[model samples]
Each structure stands twice: as structure tokens, then as C-alpha cells.
Target: MALLITKRCINCDMCEPECPNQAISMGDEIYQIDADRCTECVGHYDTPTCQQVCPIDNTIIIDPQHIEAREALWEKFVVMHHPV
Candidate 1:
């Protein structure tokens, strides 16, 4: 599933650079996660780098509206990183 940055984000700016897909960006008030570009770092790493680096707990959560299976995420990763 794609991840969403909640209001709990402290705007620390730590998670943005950790995203291998460059899915995280500055929002109006805080950081936001781009579901289209987000694959939870599946192809890049075992765990989500943004989540791992975010200091605020619960700031990053799965986007229920954009829920996806593991395989779907992996497919997205491959398509994004290895487009033909």
C-alpha cells in the first residue's frame, strides 16, 4: 500500500530525502506522500526508508484510499525504476 503523511508530521524534512522514488515532498503545511510515485520502497529496500527515518511516530501511515497488494507495489517499483 502507498503511504500517507498525517498531520502528525513535524515538518522535520527528514523523510523527504529518504524516499528513493522521490515520492515525498513539501505540502502546504507539512510533508505529503505521492501515492502515484510511492511503492513503500519495495524495489529499493526491504522497509520503507521514509518511515524508518521519520522521528515522529505514527506520522506515516498506509493510505487506505490507495491500498495495494505487495505484488502491485513491486510491479509499480519495477515499472518506475525500469521503464521500457
Candidate 2:
């Protein structure tokens, strides 16, 4: 599933640079994750790099509205990083 950065984000600038998919960016108030580009780091790391790097607990959580299976996430990764 894609991840969501909650309002609890402190804008520490930890997650934005860690996302391999470049899905994380500065939003109006905090960092935001683009569901269309997010793959939970499926093809890049065992766990999402943004989640791992985020110091605030539970600041980054799965998007209930954009849930996706591992295979789907992988496909997104492939298409994003290895487009033909």
C-alpha cells in the first residue's frame, strides 16, 4: 500500500530525500506522499525508506484509501524505475 504522511510530520526533512520513488514532497504544511508514485519502497528496500528514516512514530502510515498488494507495488516500481 502507498504511505501517507500524517499532520504530525515535523518537517524535519528526513523522509523527502529518502524516498527512492521520489513520491514524497513538500506539501502546503508538511511532506506529502503521492500515491500514484508510491510503492512503499517495494523494489528498493525491505521496508519503506521514508518510514525507516522518519523519527516521529506513526507519522507515516499506510493509506487506507490507496491500499495495494505487494505485486501491484512491485509493478509500480518496475514501471517507475524501468519504464520501456
On TM-score, the leading prediction is 2
Give the per-residue lDDT digits (tens) of candidate 2, residues 1-84.
Answer: 899999999999999989988999999999999999999999889989998899999999999999999999999999999999
Candidate number with greatest lDDT: 2
What overall lDDT goes with each candidate model? 0.94, 0.95
- Candidate 1, residues 2-63: lDDT per residue as tens digits? 99999998899899988999999998999999999999999999999998999989889999
Where model 1 places Cα greater than 4 Å from the true spot, the runs are none
Residue 31 error for model 1, in Å?
0.5
| TM-score of model number 2 | 0.98
